[model samples]
Target: MFGGSRRVRQAALFDGASLPRKHISLGGWCGPALMLGKLGLRTEAYPFDFSRVTLDGLMHFIQNGFAEGFYPPGPPPYRPECVGPWVLFRGQHTAFAHFDLNDPRVQAHFQVKMHRFDAVLDAPERPVTFFRTVTARHPQEELALALDLEEAVARRNRSLDFRIVFMVHDQGLRASAVQLAPLSPRVSLWALRYRGLPSDTLFDRTHTAYHAVMLHSVAEENWSAVKVGVVPPPPATMASAEGWDFERNVLVCDGAARTEDVPFADLTITRFPWRSHDNLALIDGVASVGGTCTGIGSTKMLANASAALHVQRLARLKCRYCGDATYHAAGRPFRTDRPFTDEEDQLVLIHLYKILTGGDKVAAVEKLAHEMRRGTYEVICRIQYLTNSSTKLMDSFDPNSLSDP
Candidate 1:
């Protein structure tokens, strides 16, 4: 006896923060989070590598130690809102890379030995929640995992209390129609795809009109809808718009053009100063507790934290470059290529002296550019003017100021 109507309502909440979905190869949690956000589901993503750890190893952790807050050290699993009857696991995108799941032996292994859903099926209350999706970036891979898992479940236990969902990407729905049409009644299917692609000029950009259509399809549960070609390009007026307004954190599009507003937080996380999005979310086996180095797990979380600090430093450098804080404090507009004051030159010398004395002349000029909010070319010219034996600016200033803190 399933819990009936109450279970339907609870399951629809769609809060799967605990399981933390990611494409891994794609932009990780940021893209998935954005897509889910379009559907009005707020997820605090904590991504982990689904490919590295063995399936049995993951199951063991959940079965033996999930209770008493013994969940993985990454992503602060103790958050109250993160809990739900449904648990989503990000399937390995490359599950079928080398081996075929269709092979009877492999199917048997998953059904008899692996027993992946034993914990969910054997729970105390008969759960009415649909088996939350097993997500993957590749539509073919996700569809395969869904179909095979559903088949294994049917062979052994046909009277499942909850629906098993097979999710296909919108781009993959047309090609997958024949196989999907014949799915068992207990097994449902949904079309969920990420549409946003990385933009060179901005953190991310998407076809605003196409995105609305995609959102509508998902919201209505239209699993048969297929997305074709790439997302349609934005309006022509957007191309003529002014540059990025760093102060407003938005592109200065024409008034007639629709502005695609990506939140600043999303921008930073997506454009993480780090090399890639791999380590943004806390991993189950990889991220240490509190993202520190002393924990019993991998130190990738500590490295992520360090990378976040580095991003903050970069932001500060940009602020100085744009004269944001300094000009704003003085109640003046930031002007570019203004003549440097004598005090400013002195400040530049104080910072550049350390780098120059270290025998890295090129680095000294670069460092001066960052410190003085000037271009590298200008910094180089200024350095030459200051250092020349016959220069007038070098004659008046005391060399002792270069050594001053």
Candidate 2:
């Protein structure tokens, strides 16, 4: 019923992070996005990755926050500039655009200080090469004349010493390139954790945009009505199982726990990072959405983790009694192993979701249980616990409801 690809690692990392399985949603970016909200960063969510729906989803929450105030409120209110969507499509004009640097709107919408489309540090040895690299997306008269586009941007911004966010793929993984990128200040280079992009797009510079598949599953819902969390559809994608799993690419930005390369992790300068599942338990602020500037499905960092753990953790009260390690007690091999497959997990999720959201539907749960290969009784017991627990939690005022705290 559900389909998406997010493979897990051979071993899990539960060290230091003792988060209750219930609080974490594994697999998809949806789980990670929800996890971010749980961490109090007040995530402004975007669905369909780089599609128009993504922009619509963001605008939906932006206007919602303006109209109804952000759910799980905080002091000073949540603003768009303080938040970055889970991903962005840089090739889109409006998607990656910055208004006139001097305009009030620019400060209102974005954090960038430069007015031009490109920002570079120091003069380049090969200005034409640099021009081709940076200005591939921009068709400017000044660039055609072979002007020092980098210098012009610097002069226009009135700052020679600045930061460069030069993002690349695994092929661009030269430590020397980092030092060569910017002459002053510091350059925060983003390297994709995995290298599985299209043949021509080994390194994403200009002209990089999100594919149309970004909005494939979402069409019925009004983008404006959605919040910055998991979208509709009872069970989130395999993203929860594969895409959001902490053990996989780790959909949730469990902070810099997954960060490497630099002697010390720099939140201000690290590349696209997904953390261990337990990483978020140690953090106290909004997760840095990272620098994946394309569709949602492509990012390993935004997907990942255990199948049994995912179901038990996310199905609310109905999931409370589900035993994940029971197979060991019964002298049976573990059902799921490293490098998870989505179809089987989808069955588990479908059965559990029926319990979580449709507690009254006895036939539906039974029907799903009947369809499964084994362990039907255990599934029923767990779902019953989840339903009862969820009812109790829903009937009370809870502190966990305070998202920003």
Candidate 3:
């Protein structure tokens, strides 16, 4: 989904839908605004940390402008642009004020506000409200926020249907904790996990890709097609020399001879240790068709075999590397919270190696826990500390440091 033609296709699909005119980002991080800007939509930011504002404070802001003493009437924290109701219109990058749920003043103004702003405008424009938080003060903070949001929406008029997206970044919370969090009919939680190569660029790309696919599905009203198109079944494994074929060829660069198939016997395929999956797939394919560089049978058979084998290989590779792919099975019921033994640390590294070598991390961790007869949380914590390259403990320590005492 990265090529020029693929981008063009996504753009064309997006062009068909009537997107929101503006986005209202309720504090937290800049991710929502950044994503909205990429979609060519106007965004009104409330800034990060200020996203922790109480529901009452938010409702108050929508009803009235910034209340008296909401921010200091000085030049430091409160700026001219971030004052009054106009602040919402123009948008503010600074946290003018933050009201926690525990604040006595917040409890005083515990009234929900739902206005009909669209009614006043000639062209009714739908504005989406997006909020994302990486902060987790308490274990149930996300669930509480979700519940508070639901309450805010529930008390309001049903006709004023504006989309409110509350995103909570996973902070190593248990599956049970997440399951306990209730969801409204309109509210949906999307758990996007990291595949590999944890970087900002990868995150942006992954989020954008998902955004495109989601838009396409929403536009087409074919939601089920998304999973089908994205996650195809892995092809049968290539084992013996039956339907596999390997060819060594060099590209013909000349303009006239470019169309011709030029075969070069001396082409060397360098096998790298890093590309274990690719090398393994190729070896299996070669062994299946015929353990030789030369053609085994008819051109059609060879071509079909090559295409099918590659397709399967790619499918399996994608599943292994896909962040959204579910790898952990749920059969174990017991949980343990104990210190990791030296032997357990070694097993954790073994699982970590699988993840580094393009294996599904969830599956690896689950397997590690099962094999070691330990809890998944314990295994995860062990891996986290060991892989923390910033610490001297990780740098100085060796995987094979355990001696035969």
Query: Which predicted model would earn the best TM-score?
Result: 3
> For all candidates, what are the clash counts?
0, 25, 4
| CA-lDDT, candidates in order | 0.29, 0.24, 0.31
lDDT-wise, the better of 1 and 2 is 1
Name the runs in model 3 displaced over 4 angstroms. 1-17, 20-24, 41-60, 63-65, 68-124, 127-134, 153-158, 171-182, 195-405
Sliding window of 10 residues with minimal summed lDDT for model 3: 82-91
**Model 3, 221-327: lDDT tens per residue?**
32222331122211134221321123322222222212232222211111101111111111112210111111111011111222334421121111111121111
lDDT of 2 by residue, 1-405 (tens): 011123322232222343311111111123222222333321222321111112222223222322221111122221111111111111111121111122344334332312111222233211111101111111121112222323444454454433222222222221211111122222222222322433222122112111111121112232223332222221233334322342332233213323333321221222222122211110112221221122110112222234445431121111111222211011121121223236645664565665456342323333443345323233333444545635221121121221112
TM-score each candidate: 0.26, 0.20, 0.33
Question: Cα deviation of 67 in candidate 2 (Å)?
Answer: 14
Query: Given candidate 3, what's the lDDT at residue 360?
Result: 48
> Which regions of candidate 1 are displaced past 4 Å?
1-121, 124-142, 151-160, 168-182, 190-197, 200-405
lDDT of 2: 0.24
Q: List the residue pairs that clash in candidate 3.
A: 240-288, 241-288, 242-288, 244-289
